[model samples]
Each structure stands twice: as structure tokens, then as C-alpha cells.
Target: MTRKPSGQRGPVDHERRDQIIAAAHEHFRLYGYKKTTVADLAKAIGLSTAYLYKFFESKKAIGEAICSLCHDTLLSDIQAIVKDNITPSEKLRKIFQSLAHNGAELFLHDRKMHDIVASAIEEKWHAAIAFDQELSSIIRNLLLEGRERGEFERKTPIDETCRAIVLSLQPIRHPALLEYNLETLDNDATMIANLVLRSLAP
Candidate 1:
């Protein structure tokens, strides 16, 4: 939210903010995130650029909001997998496979939306930061559960192991790198998960 100098209008209208984001998502899909402008979004949504700024500080902020929404949807899918009544090892494998599958799907099929996320990640937007942190927590929790159940080794520090696992998956998980390894992404994801599981075995 932006600060009003003095005597602004009514409260920060969330309805209007949502309207802007909805319009932006469509326009961005059509025009690509790099080419779309804030003025273009405002004109499409029947709002003034200045008015839009009241809800979002800048064009990137609007993108961040959309990115966050997308991340939430993806996170929901991950959380579902985490909660499934399956072995921790299976959960770990499925999680990595899902991440690779989704990343490839977005990059190969939804290139426009993928660009928005690529920008967010490359720019280190708050949406990307928050998503990464939440994802790390999820992975850490899964590791802890596996260790508690005697499915994984407890000798290594869990934090270090979690960090290594995430780093190992970056090539498949990252948008920009997804294209380069599409041919072998699935195999690589499986291999990485297997290696991690083997390392974690009690």
C-alpha cells in the first residue's frame, strides 16, 4: 500500500486492487510482462494510472501480487502432496517430480505466465522471496518427519541437508533453466530425489 501525502480519498480499496490485478494478468498474458505497461493496465481496467498507484506502488508491485497468487496455487498442490497418506520417501520423490513437471509445464506451455515468474525470480521480488522461504519450510518439515520416523539419517544437520536438496533441484525448478534441460528434467529430478533419499537412509 502507498502512503497518501494528505487528505486522500476513501480507504485503500481492495476491490479495486483485485480488479487491477485481474486485468493485468490478462493483458500480461497477451502482451508479455516485459512489454505491458502500468498505463496500459489502467486504461484496460477503466481506472486512472494514478488511482492504480494508490493500490500498488508500482507496476512491479502489481506483478508481484499476481506472482504471489500463482505461487499460492502451486503451493497448494505441493501441500496436498505433503499431506497424502504415503511414505516420506515417496512423498519426497513425488514432491520433486511435481516441481519439475509443473515448472516444465509452465515454461513449455504457458510461456507468457512463465515470463512473469521468471522476472519475479530474477528480480528477487518479494513474492519470489516469500515463496522460496515457504517452500524451504515445507521441505524442512518433510525432512524432519522422515528422520523422526527412522526413514532418514540423523547424523547430518537437517538444515544443511535441506539447503543442499533445494540447490540440487534449482536447474529443474528455476524458470530460466527449465528450458535448457527439458529433455532430461524428469530423469534428473528422479535421480536427484533418489540420491537424496539414499543419503538420508538410516
Candidate 2:
């Protein structure tokens, strides 16, 4: 939640923060990180840079906010897919569907998202890898669990399987792969997710 320095607003500060994030998401999706500037974002959000400053110190902060939102959404979707006490195969199928259903919109709308994230790799590598690592850990642990549960093939190393899932996700970084393989980015998401899930399933 963000508080007005003047203490003038009498509402939940979280709402105001969400509004800022909405604006950031729109602007960044359109102009991307390198092309986006503080002044433009401030103007679009109908606030002065000084006021915006009170909430976000820099463009990178906005990028971080965007990344955080995407990461949370991805995790939530994955969690929902696995929330029920279903079989491993069903969990894998749902994971693919969830990622495919919503993930394509993310890449199509903001093609520059990966670049913005990649640029931050050197400085914020840990933060940048947090989502993938967490998801990979989940995959690895699940595979181990699945093996013990007699629900999966007992062949490849768990780490290797997890790495494959994460690497399949990396195809989004390729412009041609994103554009050509499927009719649209959204279509691509489902196709890729399906393939990944199959690779892990028996």
C-alpha cells in the first residue's frame, strides 16, 4: 500500500498502488523498458514525476513491479492446477492448459518483456531467476513425489526433467519461434505447455 505524503486521501493505499501498477503495465507493454521514460509514465497516470517519485523511484522499480505481478500470476495458476488431490498426469495436463490459456497473452502483448527482464539479469539475476527456479523446484519435487507414488517413469534424473521444462519455457525468447510455430502467441503458449507437460508425464 502507498500512503499519500500529505495524508490527504482517506482510502486504502493498496488500491492506489494497484492503480499505479495498472498504468505501468499498460505503458510498459506499449513502450517497453528502454523506450519508456519516467515523465511519460507520470503524465499517463495523471501525476507529476514528483508524486510518482513518492511511489516509484525509477523505471526499473516499475519493471520490478511488472515482473512481480507476472510471476505471482504464473504461480497462482500453477497452484490452482495442482490444488486438487488429483493424479500426477492430471496435474501435468492442467499445468499445461493453464500456462497455455493465459501465458500467450503475456508474450504477445509485451514482446519486450523478456528483453527488459534480460537486461536486469546481471544486476538482479537472483530476482530474475526466482520465478523459474521456484517453478523448477516445484517440478523437481513433484517428479520425485510422483516417482515414489508410482505415477511417473523412473528414468531420467529429476533435475534433468525440471531443466527441460524450464528450458522449453525459454523458447518464448525467440521471436520467430513465438510467431511461426503457432498462429498467434496465445496459441503458441498452449502448444508449448502441452509439449512440456507431455515430456514430464508418463
Candidate 3:
């Protein structure tokens, strides 16, 4: 996650930064990310463009913040899934399904916000990287639990297995790649999760 900017205006004031993000989110949602400008955002919120820079370095930075917020919320939901009273196998299935559905919702319904995420993925922004890392960690823990419970094989190293599972889900997980598999993402997510579970069989 990018550090929330702080300047000579005393301690960090997230109220202003959050205000900027709230406005940007609405603006981006309305006008799309690429077509919107920082100055336009400043105008929308009644702040000067220079003052807007105090919280975010550039337009991309603001985009990153918005993108990160989305990722964080999704991650929290997924984390709750992990904590649910479900088997590791079932958790894995749910995780993949949720990811596929979320991607489809973004691309098919929220095109404007999807544009921000697409750019974040294309540019390998911090938000995307951080989301992937944290997700991989969650998957790793799930795999370890499965192995300990004899629900999954332990022959393969967890890291390699985790990477393979992540890669297998990437077609649906990635924004840029979502369109190609849009028609079959729901079925594909379940099928892929099942396939991974089979491979992990003890």
C-alpha cells in the first residue's frame, strides 16, 4: 500500500485525503479514469490543483489510492471467507468463485472503475502488487491447513503449489485478461478450483 501523504500541514490528515478519494471515486465513476484530469477533480471538490497534490503526487497516485481501496475491501471479504466454518477445499472453491464473479461484475457492470483497475494491472501498480501478495499469502495458509488435515497432498512445495493455483486463476483474476474469458468465468472458476483440488489430492 502506498503511504498516505503527509506534508508541512502538521500531522497526516486523512480527512482531506479521504475527501479527495471520495470525490475522485465519484468523478472517475462518472467520467471514466483516462478522460478525467487532476484539475477536474480539484474543481469537483473545490480545491486548487496544487492543494490536491498535497495528498496525492499525481493523477495516477489518486487512481492508485482508489484502486487500493477497492482491493482492500475485496481482500477483507475474502479473508472473512477464509475464516468461515468451511473446509479448506470449500474455502478454495469459494475464493475462486468470488474472484471470478467480482471480476465479471467490474468489467461487465462497472466499466469506469474497471478502467482504473485495468491501468493499475497494466502498469504493475503498487495496489495490484500488494493485492496479489496478500492473496498469495492467504492461499498459502489454506494449502498448509489442507495438508495438515490430510485433505491435500504434501509432496509439492507450498510455494510452487500456491504459485500454480494463483496462475491457474489469473485468467479470471486479472482485469486485462478478464474479457477473453468473460463468457465462461463462472464455470471456469469452479472447474479450475476443482482441478487444483484434484491435483492437491492426498
Candidate 4:
């Protein structure tokens, strides 16, 4: 029987890689990134540490994969909101609310997970930066739509306006800020939406 070439992964290898990532997520959630080790993750998935390393380079890599999964899920949710058939103003409001609501639920619910997220941001992980850029682009697209639909009067360049909108709503959109005062996200979202809308009025 012929064996697969070295470094070539088959279907089973992919499945095992996914299983390791899933198990690592749970371990990170329960034990936090700093405390979780490759051995713990490998044992949870019924694999030896050396075998797990064939899938992930290190425990940090596993943590990064978990973080990427979360960011991808968030981007999907925001993309859905952006695609909905609704007025730009309403979409903006919903987007603000969703950012705060979902971020708080994901990070604030578990202190260990929150710490992991904080560290990711501090380290400027590639996934985290990509997530932020995508979100900013979504906001930019919404602003352009508002301008095209005659819902907003231009006071500045569209790009600048979009940046301002994102910066202005940072308290409700930034995970760290949201974590600091989650209880007021709902009220703050409403107020910020109204203020932004009024500023954009013709």
C-alpha cells in the first residue's frame, strides 16, 4: 500500500485539526489562554502532545485560531446586518447595537475569555486587525449608501465622515470600552445613533 507523502494532509488530518481547534477553544474558555497548555488540549481531544503539534505550532497558535473563529463569526453577523433591506439610518443603529450587544455577550460573559481577547488586542493579532478593518469598511459602505440615497448631507469627505462616525461611536463599538460599561450599551447606542443621524441630516 502506498502512503501519503510527508507534510501532505488527508481528510482525516483536516478533521483532527478541526477537533483540536474546537477542544482548544473550550480549554481556553475554561482555563484561560495563559493557563491552557498543548498537553491539556491534546488530552481533551484524545491526542498526544507531539501529535497535536503536527496540527498547531503551539498553544498560542491554537488560541489564535479560536480568536479567528470568533472574529469570523462576528464579521458574518455584521455583514448580515449590512445586507438587510433597511434604511441606512436604521442599519447604522442596528449595527451599533449589535456590536455592543454581541461583544459584551462574547467577551464579558467569561472573565477568562475577556482576558484572552484583551491580550489579543494588545498583541495586535492579525485576525483582530482584519476584523476591525472589515467593520470599518462596513461603516464606510453604509455612509456611502446614506449619501447616495440623499439621507445625509455631506459636511466632509465620505472617507473622513466614515472615520468620524466610527470614532464617535467607539464607546459602543470598541470591545474594551464596551467591557468597561456593558450595562449602558443599549442606552448609549440609541443616543449615539440619534446624534449621528442628526449630524448627517440635510
Candidate 5:
């Protein structure tokens, strides 16, 4: 039997890398980042730890990849909501609520995974920064649309107003703020959104 050339391993290598990432994601979600070691991930995929290292240099590397995937999924959701055929005001409200809801679910469903996110943010990970920038951009675009539609009045520059909006809702969107009870978090989000809307009213 003829063996495949080394250059022909691209597709197979990509597939294996993805498999390793998926396995690591599940392990981290279930067992927390600190508890889920490279050995565990390799065992899950029926590979040796040395082989896993060929795909990801370290466990932190795998964790970063997983965080990137999650952030991409979130950005896609926000992008879709922004482009939906809804009033700018309604879209803004939904975007705020969706972000709060997603953060809360992540905190409550898997504290381990949430901890990974917290560390990523604290470490200033590239994926975390990109995620934050994308979210800000979405909000800024929505505010611009609102201004064009005369649904909102901007007392300050659009960029400043966008920053204010994000800061005002940080309690709901920030992982550190997820320590509050669910009811309190929900109420705070509602009140904050209302205040932002009122501030932006024409």
C-alpha cells in the first residue's frame, strides 16, 4: 500500500486539531480549567499527551481556542440581531437583554467555564479583547441607526455615547457582576436599559 505524502496531511491535521479543541472544550466545561489537564484531554480523544501537544502547545492554548470559538458564536448572534428587521430601539433592548442572559447562563450553568472566561479577561487575552471590540462596534452601529431614525437623541458624541451605554450595562454583561442573584440581575438590566433609552430619547 502506498503511503500519503507529508504535504497531503493538511486536511487530516486540521480535522484532528478541531477534534482536540472540541474535546478540551467539553472537559473544561465539565471539570473547570484547572482540573482538566492535557492528559485528560488526550485520554478523551484516545491520544497520548505528546500527540496532543503537537496540535496545541499547552492547555492554555487549547483554552484560548475554545474561548475564541465561544466569542465568535456570540458575535455572530449579536450581528444577526443587529441586522434583523426590527426598530432600532427594539433591537438595542434585545441586544442588551441577550448579552445579560448569555452571561448569566454561562455563570450559572458552568462556573468552571465562566472562571476560564474571567481569567481570559483579566489576562487581556487577544480573543477577549476582540470579543469586546466587536460587541462595542455592534452597539455603536445600533446607536447610529437610532439617531438616523430619530429614535434617539445624542447629547454627546456617538463614540462617547456608545461607551456610556456599555458601561451602564456592565453590571449585567460583565462576568464579575454575575455574583448577584438572578432576579436582581434581571431587574438591574431592565432598569439600566430603560435609563439608557430615556437618556437617548429625542
Candidate 6:
């Protein structure tokens, strides 16, 4: 319980709420959001369903909370990378490389993450669509910047081209994008980064 702005006592445990969200992340990451029930979440956190309901009424809500945490972190990372004085195309490469090279875990783990998101809600839910828009926007910015820097053709429409580039990179997160036995996923990411840089360069 806590004191409200109105001076009456209210009840909300923000810290515990985050703990539950963390537990939800682990559960969803393992069993996926679809297969993970509220009961599972409650059990994982050592709480009853009734208590879990007090925090998050549904599994979808918990899933959204987990996705929000992940998406925010990635978005923040992208923003920081873009803060450098690099050209737009360079920035785009840096953004992707950071995810693929620096954060390979994010790409590989996305297999389970994708399943969770797809199961928890519609593909266009805020968390999913927001990321799509954020990437598209980044690509659009880079396209416009590339045209000015002579790094790309001026005829390319900013939004469409960016979306295409973003979609193309999705295969990197796919389980079958390349054979893991032949080369490590890290090597594949490097190959992909080089391929995109060379192929997309003017």
C-alpha cells in the first residue's frame, strides 16, 4: 500500500510488478507466449493465479510488458548509434552490425521471441508495429541521407525502400537463414552485413 496524491492510502507495488514482468520474460522466452498460461507465470513466480491477476490480468498483458522492455532497449541502442557523426548509410550499417555483431544473442533469441509475439497478439500490435515503424523510419532516414551523399540512387522512394531493406534483414533472425553447423551464426552475420553493404552501396 502507498499514499496517493489525494492523501488517501492506495496499493501498488511497482517493484514487485517489475519482478513479475521479469519472470514473465523468462517463461515466455522458454515456452513461448502461446503455450505459457497465466498459471505457468504464477507458478514460475511462486505466486497464485489470484495474486498474479492482481498484477497482470492476462497472459497477453504480461507478454506485452516483456516485449515492451526488449523493444525499448533496442530502440535506445539504435538512437545512441545514430548519435555519431557518421553518414546515414554508415549509421544504418552500424545499427545492423550492433545488433548482429555486438548483440548476436538478440538475433538468435528472436526465434523464440517471434513465436511469443506472434502468439500473444496480432502482428500489428503496438509493440510489433512500433518496431516495424522504427526500423522503417531509420531506413528512410538513411535512404534520404544516402541519396544526398551519393551513396544511393535518388529515385528510391524513402519509405518503400527502407521497408524493403528492413524486411530483407528479417531472414537473419530466421532459424533457416543459414546452416549453423557450417559456420557460426556470428560469421553469417558478418557475411550478411558485408553483403548488404556491398549490394546496397551506390
Identify the candidate with maximal lDDT: 3
Q: Which ten residues in a row have the lowest lDDT in candidate 2?
A: 3-12
Order candidates by lDDT, high to low.
3, 1, 5, 4, 2, 6
Q: By how many angstroms RMSD does model 3 differ from the true structure?
A: 2.5
In terms of lDDT, the poorest run of 10 residues in model 6 is 2-11
lDDT of 1 by residue, 32-138 (tens): 98997889988988889888877777788888878887888889989999999998899889989999999998888878889999999999988888889988999
Q: What is the lDDT of residue 71 in candidate 6?
A: 66
Model 2, global lDDT: 0.65
TM-score of each: 0.91, 0.68, 0.93, 0.84, 0.85, 0.71
1 or 2, which is superior by TM-score?
Answer: 1
Supply the TM-score for candidate 6: 0.71
Cα-lDDT of candidate 1: 0.85
lDDT for residue 78 in candidate 5, whole number 0-100: 79
Backbone clash total for model 6 is 0
| lDDT tens per residue, model 5, 1-202 | 5322121223334778778778788778777887878888889879999888776667777777777777777777778888899998888887777877878888888777778878778888766777888888888989998999889996679989999988887788778876675667777777788888989999
In Å, residue 195's CA in model 3 sits off its true spot by 0.6
Clash number by candidate, in order: 0, 0, 0, 0, 0, 0
Which residue pairs collide, candidate 4? none
Runs in model 4 deviating more than 4 A are 1-13
lDDT of 4 by residue, 122-151 (tens): 788765676778878988888889989999
Cα lDDT tens digits, model 3, 32-107, are 9999898999999899999987777789888988898889878987998999999999999999999999989988
Top of the candidates by TM-score: 3
Segments in model 6 whose C-alpha atoms lie over 4 Å from true places? 1-13, 28-34, 106-125, 174-184, 190-195, 198-202
lDDT of model 5 at position 42: 86
CA RMSD per model (angstroms): 4.1, 5.8, 2.5, 5.3, 5.9, 6.2
